[model samples]
Target chain A: MNFIAEIDVMPLKELLDPQGKAVAAGLKNLKLDAITDVRVGKHITLKLEAADKATATAQAELACQKLLTNRVIEYFTFEVKEA
Target chain B: MNFIAEIDVMPLKELLDPQGKAVAAGLKNLKLDAITDVRVGKHITLKLEAADKATATAQAELACQKLLTNRVIEYFTFEVKEA
Candidate 1:
């Protein structure tokens, strides 16, 4: 089975996002005055070929813990769907 | 108008993804032997409250350039849909 997973990695809320901040400031230039709290993060979509959902989830969790996140500065989770 | 945007940010291929590397190694524990090239990145879904579609795209792009990417190490783009 193949699963499609969407993952997000963001700095903790308490942490400052320089990129997000810069983005917010730039939006101000374009007259997007309604925009606020423009937090920025990364998104990744992966195709995981596993024998089953359990295996796929395990693979995803393992991926999150071992390679997908810094745990110290970032966090991640997946929305798994059949592919 | 409101827009839903999906964003992805990843390290340039030349930059090593330590977390991605660690994740690949961990998948080995799950018997996912076929899995390879498991690069990791972040995903963010944004709701841009704007007056029009063109404005929404510009806001989203500004968000990417000024906040979302670290040009030295990362890059990003968006998938915009009507909301």
Candidate 2:
């Protein structure tokens, strides 16, 4: 079976996101005052071969743990579906 | 009304994503060979004040066009909900 995974890796909310802060400031400068806050993260799309959805989900999780996120400052979530 | 927008900015499928290629290579090095391909993009979470859902969605779209994306190489999609 083939699967597609959409993964989102975000900074821990407890941590300060400098990039997000900068963007917020920029938006303010652009007069987008309605936009009060911004948080920036990574969106990753993966295409893979798996035996089943469960295997695909597990593989995606392992991939996130091993390569996609910094456990100390970031967390990740993902969903897998047939391609 | 307060709204939260989840925005996804993705590289155009026609373009080359060097970062994605690097990650794919790294995954292979880590022996996660079931993963066949990868594409990476930006995930942005925005908190904003608006009068209604339609207004919030319009604000998000404007923000994307004015600052968040370079239309020549990327495209964006978003969903807005009450915060």
Candidate 3:
């Protein structure tokens, strides 16, 4: 079986986001007054082949830990689709 | 005009991702031995009403800073579409 997954990582609200801040400033330069804040992150979409949905999901999670995200600051989730 | 945006944030590789690691372990429990890595983050989709694509993009970026994500660790981007 194969599955598709969408994953993401972000800074916790209590944390500071310099990248976001820089983006915010950049947005301001674009003259968007209604915009006040900016945060940044990554979104990954991929398909996995495995024996079952459960197995595929497990593999996807493992992939997230080792290759998709760093272990110190990121948190992630996904809805897996079997094909 | 209106636009839809997808946004994400993640830990840099230099940073540690306890969240991704935890997810990886959880996946191991699910019996997905083939999986090798995991990373975690947030994804948001929203529609913005504005005067132009450029203006809408600016507003979308602002929304990301103030509402969509936290600014400490997150950096984000989007592809805006007029609706």
Candidate 4:
């Protein structure tokens, strides 16, 4: 079966996100005062061939752990669905 | 009310995502041959003050249009929920 994995890799909440802070500051300059905070991360869409959902999920998990994220600073979550 | 908007900014399907292609190559080198394709994008989380969902959604949309995306090559989608 073919599957699609939507993966989100985010900075650990305990850590400061400079990019987010910068975006918030830019928003304030734009007079978007209502926007109080911003956090930016990576969203990845993967299309792959797998025998089943479980296999696809496992493959995605491995990809996240091995290449998609920096474990010291970021964590990842993913959902696998039929393509 | 305080609201959170989860926004995804993606490269247009017609555009070539060099970053995505690079990741796919890295995955292939890692021997994850089951994965056939990858697309990388930005995921943004926004915290804001708004009177209601509609207001929050509108704020997010405005942010996307004004500062978060390059409309010529990318598009965005968002979901707003109570924070």
Candidate that would win on DockQ: 4
Write model 1 residue lDDT over A1-83, tens digit each, in one string. Answer: 77867678777767887877776677678666656546677665556888888887776676667766688887776787787
Q: How much of the real interface does each model capture, measured as fnat?
A: 0.36, 0.81, 0.23, 0.87
DockQ of each: 0.30, 0.86, 0.17, 0.89
Q: If you score just chain A, what TM-score does every candidate get?
A: 0.93, 0.95, 0.80, 0.96
- Clashes by residue pair, model 1: A19-B67, A42-B42, A42-B43, A43-B42, A43-B43, A66-B23, A67-B19, A67-B23
**Highest TM-score among the candidates is held by which one?**
4
**Cα lDDT of model 3 by residue, A2-49, tens digit:** 676767655665777777787667656756554455556666655566
Per-residue CA lDDT of candidate 4, range A1-83, in tens?
Answer: 99999998999999999999999999999988889999999999999999989989999999999999999999898899999
Q: Across residues B1-83, which tens digit of lDDT does each residue of candidate 1 receive?
A: 66777778778879888877776666677666645546677665567887888887777777777756688998776787787
What does candidate 2's lDDT look like per residue over A1-83, in tens digits? 99999999999999999999998998888888889999999999999899999989988999999999999999998999999
Number of clashing residue pairs, candidate 1: 8
Q: lDDT ranking from best to worst?
A: 4, 2, 1, 3
TM-score of each: 0.61, 0.97, 0.53, 0.98
User: Which structure is stronger by lDDT: 2 or 3?
Assistant: 2
Q: Which of the two candidates, 1 or 2, achieves a greater TM-score against the reference?
A: 2
**Would you list the clashing residue pairs of candidate 2?**
none
lDDT of each: 0.71, 0.94, 0.64, 0.95
TM-score ranking from best candidate downward: 4, 2, 1, 3
Model 2 segments more than 4 A misplaced: none
